[model samples]
Target: MNKNNTNSDSSVKTVKRNKTRESLPPKKYQVLEQDWSINQDGVNIYGRLYLPQNLPGKKKAVILSHGLAGNYRDVTKYAQYLAGQGYVAYAFDYPGGAKNGCSTGVGQLNMSIFTEEQNLKTVLNAVRNRSDVDRYQVSLLGESQGGAVSAMLASKYPKEVKSLILLYPAFSITDYAQVAFKSINRVPDTLNLFGFTVGKNYFAKLFNYDLLKSATKYNGPVLIMHGTDDIIVPETYSEKANKKFKHSKLYIFKHAGHDFKGKYVTRANRLITDFLKKN
Candidate 1:
């Protein structure tokens, strides 16, 4: 595996990794961090790559995607944890994914689920092409809006994506958009959504895309996690998704809201690790 922070590809620039100390991986399976960035359609999508430095042989990979108005940091903890478990974990910030994202070009006004889907696709291609990664074993771990994107991609690339993991997916986006705007003609140039200002394009392809229906196309193993107390996206959505997938399991965390916190975080982490290990 390429351990040094250098690459010959002009499109792939390797930058300094973070040094903040926390939980370290096992001595025999130390983890190495790298700052990775790729340009897609003039937009610079930035992300961090976590590799098990000492682990031998090709490793399975997991791409972690964040939710709406959220950046790569939202999934960084999961990435780090997964990396410690001998899997290659990548966490990236989608262009226009957040008000303040590491990626450049495209603002929130031009961002939409479709655009984010394209960004995730780009990340998937980049990660799969890595020399040390097992392309056939690549999995996707998406949170909220990202989960919806992962589902769509997994459906499209069923053979490539080995497994799927959704964390409180925003499968209700289409319903919420239709009810809020009534019609596309009523969509304003910009509007406040869940405390974030976004453009009408935010709902551009939602009306046509059937997330749950499309998600059912992927025949790989699927793991869906949701909070029992989640109001933003009720646990019922996940329950329905669990039923839609050909092979899937749904776990509900009691008292956990849209974002898992406190003891729920530990439970979620453990659950995710266990799921990935099994699949």
Candidate 2:
């Protein structure tokens, strides 16, 4: 990438390396980063589209979703990697998803799983409608809260999603909401959570949501990765999901936490690419 051209749509072309790690293969094409934004419910959802130069015909695409309060930049690396592997990649910021997000409208006060779900659907439809994308081969990859959103969408539109990949998904959110307030009557109108001010709507749908049940509705292949030491969202949630899905595999990283780190990230990426290729 050219340091001076980072912000331009036609600016960055991923640099290729002569040597590659045994675990990670060399990129197939020079990836180009472009600014791609879409309008949803009268507001703009800012995002980036990574296209592999000179790919013939319609290409398979992947939609990368960030975790709660995270922006598209947080998952930019994944988009670059997938684009390098010959797949078109997209990463976007959800409305009101982050304090400093590029997207407009909605905020922490009213952002909920349901709202995020709608945001993802809008992205999926836009990506599918692209002339260069193979609508039938689009996949969804998400982290934490975004993972839950992806799973729910895959369940609702199984035929549209080729495969699903979840990284330390927040499937326990529904249960956490119940335990936090004990019941709906005890729910407060507003509260500070993880440095964000949230309202009752944040937990409204989650109160009666069944993540695993909704997730298992999608009969497509699913790859679930979780860390054994994750305290924020215990591994048990993923374990349960793995068992419930008809065709799913779960990989547990020894020392990884809520988000992967060090070699864990590399291993997870390899697994992700492999799964996408086979599925």
Candidate 3:
């Protein structure tokens, strides 16, 4: 009887250990980074692709876009995290997207949202064509101006986009442009705004495009995140944009500003991971 009892206890211990091991998350795959160049209409758009090592099969992919005047490095952390999670991540710079970006500089003097959208499309096409990427599972993640561009792209190509994640999207660009130019017809050839020399084409394009209307066309799963205290892009814009999406979730970080950091970034990453996993 004593021997039987000891054997039963050992069996229970082994079962419990196995169960615990099963409950633990899988080990993260090693990530490799590579530089890629995507040509849009003739301009070289530079980007970084994050690939997971030791993956058994092709994985889902995400194309990340930086905010206005920002480069691919701005979203490197997100790319790294997604790559670790077994998703191939790509971050690209729009032509003249930033003053110091790696892409061919069109200069802020001629940069416009329409041009940026074209660049994004080029990157998406390049990503979709890669054998290691699951074309049907590609998603877009954009910040600020890039968020607006992503939303527009998803709307324009609903069937191609699996999901969208917009962080503090600048949906009020047209409204802000109206305020800056006073009269759209009177926009100068070049004007300075926020320390950047923006061209009249930028304001003209914003005046003609309706971001909210374009966003309404995309009915895919959308994740919109904003900071309540963000002065750059008001939380209300995100709130209003959320109402347009057929399937959308809005997260407002308390006291968080336009840029996320520290605990806030961690929180955002968690929310993003959960959303991606579900969709």
For residues 1-279, what per-residue lDDT tens digits would candidate 1 score against the true structure? 432322221121111222453233333356799999988789889989988877888889999999988888888878887887889999988888764689977787899878887888888898889888999889999999889889988988888898999899988888787777777888888988888888888877666667667755677888888887788998777776776677787777666789776566566677777778788
Please estimate how well model 3 matches the true structure, expressed as its whole-model Cα lDDT: 0.79
lDDT of 2 by residue, 151-261 (tens): 999999999999999999988888888888877678899877766777888887776777767766677888888888898899888877776676788888776788776
Query: Cα miss at 206, model 1 (Å)?
Result: 2.3
lDDT of each: 0.80, 0.83, 0.79
Residue 176 displacement in candidate 1 (angstroms): 0.5
Error of 1 at 36 (Å): 0.3
lDDT of 3 at 97: 61
Which candidate model has the greater TM-score, 2 or 3?
2
Worst 10 residues of 3 by lDDT: 9-18
**Candidate 3 at residue 158, lDDT?**
86
Q: Candidate 3, residue 36: CA error in Å?
A: 0.9
TM-score of each: 0.87, 0.89, 0.87
